[model samples]
Target: MTLRSKPYHWLYAFVLIALSAFSVQSVAETSMEQTGELQLWHKISLIFDGPETSERADYNPFIHYRLNIIFTHPATGDRFVIPGYFAADGNAANTGAESGNKWVAHFSPNHTGLWKWQASFRKNRFVAVSAKVDAGVSGGFMDGQQGQFTVSESNKELPDFRAAGRLQYVNEPYLKFAQSQTYFIKAGPDAPENFLAYQDFDGTFHNDGHKDDLVKTWEPHLTDWKKGDPTWQNGKGKAIIGALNYLNSKGLNAVSFLTMNIMGDDQNVFPYVDYNTYDRMDVSKLAQWEIVFEHAQSLGLFLHFKTQEAENQGLLDGGGTGLQRKLYYRELMARFGHHLALNWNLGEENGEWFKNHPTMPQHTNERIAMARYFYENDPYHHHLVIHNGIDYDDLFSADSHYTGASVQTHKADFSSVHTAVKRLRDWPVINGRPWAIAVDEPGDAQHSLVPDRMNPAHNNARQNGLWGALMAGGWGTEWYFGYANEHSDLTAQDYRSRDLFWDQARHSIAFFDALDVPFQRAKSHDELLSSAADYVLAVPGEFYIVYLKDASHQPTLNFKNFSGDFEINWFNPREGGEMQQGSKTTIQAKWVHKAKLNNTFNLGLPPSTPNQDWVVVVKRK
Candidate 1:
């Protein structure tokens, strides 16, 4: 038995490690020196203040930030060459009223070590330039006194984490893919502010004090809690976190919490926030909310909520005038403060309309607002994502910064792995951020309500997340009780999706964690793959995964390079076990893509007969 056979439990161990040596230049090869300026251009243009998620009293206000600059050399610490603040003058004068902050900066960092700057700013008229700006470009802080970030968004009253007179941005830069103790989001030039973080701007908190277990905030109304009517148990926040922590202990990184997920919108003639009614929202259940967050925090799991990424506009259903919807979004952002969870997906699969016209005025307006809301508010909370079809590029701006997008590529059933992975990688490189995929495996084959498809999608999604640019976390497949009749008896098996989800995620978590660190950082070597198509590779450093679906017709494996000694192990995702390793010397000259959505791998033409269903894991010298 191989280590991949038995599933491992995550205990949720985490340690905060500041980045000491990062080759930012090594990534993307897109040099900022070419794009950004260093002369003290116009600096007085925008303001970055308040808690992250702030909404204007009526209209969300635009922050005017101006940076006056000057830079000295590194080694000699010599004469001033580059003028400061990117010379913040002579830029565009007019910004659309509906649009927000228009600002820029003149800053330069020469090396990969800690870089610090003393930045001070003045807000609109009222306050003098009194804000502190001991900002550091590297992982360190303005100085030794302020490198760490303290969050108090959950509480009504601020905790005494900082000194009384200390006023700082409650922003945690989500400048990386993986979630950690503080912050979410990987910094890029996608969203305005060109970043994603959490906040309500003026430091808003709805919970009176805070439940001891608030893992992360959710709209207290998400669960089905009536007015003191306890039918379904309140979601045990702590238990959920504890369960997740256990998963993390075993190697799981994080979870995609269905915080505001509601029932089907497919059936509704007019869309509504599908789950329990809003009037039935119970504030007392807020206690339960804390417990959930506490558990998540304990287990080193970061929360990626499902909804409230934008306003619950009831049902736009075409009746929503563009102005009406956009206006509602602006206001909703002000109210919800454009925040919640790591990935604030606006909605689930609403169908062709949502996907087709992604940047339609209403959608773009809402999307832009949401992006800014999170960026201007809470960036770490802005690991933005949108769940739906394959063409993720269309879902987001060719340059818009959305929550990291993902696809529900139901493996075997809906699509193939290779196809799904292609879409995931290309989405961000050509567009913004990156996309994620899920291995959509079906446990209840006989009882599948929708189209009973499965594999290349599932396996590919997992591989892409583990090895692709869009850092895939665990599986995001559907899980729940199948549709039922009036007199249905609920059994544990009834929720086959749940069981399958837990099982698949548990196993796949092991597979993903086994591969690489900074998985998203791996460059695309798709060019060095099989030209014929039946097989594709998700290659990391010293490791490569060849997803073969040659079940129907025998495939001829032709590759560019497969030299020297290597160990090949097959992993049977179907049987939930591992296969023995095999030695390979003769490289087949013909292997074309053959697997379909149902994952029919027909590998029985010449060399060997079929054994167990397994994914080949290779360790090459």
Candidate 2:
């Protein structure tokens, strides 16, 4: 009667036993339900009926049972083994149920064709936390069930992730969409790290008495919510959902939020049902989070899941990859990893730091282990990065598992942004793999990015933080509000407080989009400029972008290594508009040495805005 002796017979007997275990009425109930638009890059959910379990059960449904769905594209033989989760009653957000027989898995098919799937449900003492695929004995109901579905082409257009496909790390300095092959450059918020500490979520954090004052209502953004938007529990999520709408309206493509912060700065955010309960998860709270996340994807916003902060890095498994860490990561991947664009940020300021108390630091081995777990477990294999408290020198080597770096620079004027970005871009060359660098935190902690009423111009932010990162071949930036500023990182409810600054960020993104140049292939060549203060990013003889931080510093390009007939155009970074003709419309390049004659081509002045920063775009015509 062993499973291996006669596999098909054993499966049949298992099914019969499972059917007898439940009443005839329960056995007649549908075992599985499929939902969502069955199209390419759209989420397709498979909800199955399993053993009825509770979040507070002695068997711990979160860690004692395992569900993995093996999905295969018949055409290309591309298979994705996606993880599944326990969904209480299959409608926990609306019903607020604590126990049920529902288990679910989500899949976003990358190709448009027939796809086959099979469920593998297993049970053991602690099988959910194990990385092994076949870690436990079979649990019968839908264990051997097989099915097929068809995915058609998506009709979604711009600003919808379905139109662009998944944003993947393709061994470049930037992430590119799989469908469009368009390189991505993000601009968004990096502050309010406790974004999930909302009042509507189902958790005990509001009354936990640990930084309960930091919980947010997100009241100001309720007006931004439009008709046909998604909400839950008699319209409980409008304010938070509207905040995402405002960010998209501002042309921001990315957002950063923390999932767990038990002992961190704002302790009101965590995924557990209770503060001290780590093994059990609040099913309804997580379901509400999925609603917000799904809306963000539809709006084309990248999710930055900062798993922990430095203060709580050691709260689970003492900063090692153990049982607690595995279960936490498993729940996240199962529930939200189906989104198109996201990066699993290991931790914010991951290393040791001291403000009022000292935090535990994860050594190089521990850090790599944590990253390796996600790299191997996540079915999508989305971009992986780690924020720095000190630096990323240890991860610059060839064995590193991270695809990018979430940088934090400490400069009030953001003067160090360029150097930090350039260093990350250059150091990884020896390993033959470049890390996509993003300046997530630009300025100092006390006065990073102030409100528009405080500094409407945002001169330093535009000149140094925005343009500086772009000119140095950095992918993008996310602004972090200083703690001392109004609407600071932890307590901010309104996004319009930095209204003027969002315009500046939008202008920068617009300039890049309008040019339509292959900037992803371009590299930083600051040494080619006459003034070291200015910056030059070029694809050698193809296209060039020269950023002049000060309009007073008239610089020239060293055309000694390049030769072509080039057209020069001027652009205003502060106020985005059409490209204007500069003082010099054209220049003929010829090879000449610096030691010999004036081999440099004078870029000349901008057509207008002579006192502010300007970007000069030169292209071979």
Best by lDDT: 2
C-alpha TM-score for every candidate: 0.45, 0.94
lDDT (0 to 1) per candidate: 0.30, 0.88
Candidate 2 residue-wise lDDT, 394-416, digit = tens: 77665678988999999999999
- Give one digit per residue, the lDDT tens place, for model 1 in 1-621: 554553541211111121322222222231122122121111111112111211122222222221222333344453221111111111211110212222222222222233233323223321111123432122111111111111221111111111111111121112332212222221110101000111110111222222212223222222322233211133322222333334444433344433332222111111111132321112213223333443343343444444421223323423233433333322222222212223455544423443334222235444445455444433123345565532344555554556444444333233343355455655433343344433222222222222113321344323332222222222233322222321011111112222233344455445443443233333334444332433334444344444443322433332333333344555444433444444343222222355222212222322233432234544444
After superposition on all CA atoms, what RMSD does each candidate show versus the true structure? 20.1, 3.6
**Candidate 1 least-lDDT 10 residues:** 187-196
Over all chains combined, what TM-score does candidate 2 have?
Answer: 0.94
The parts of candidate 1 lying over 4 Å away from their true place are 1-284, 300-302, 308-341, 350-362, 389-399, 409-412, 416-418, 428-501, 516-535, 540-542, 548-556, 561-565, 572-580, 583-610
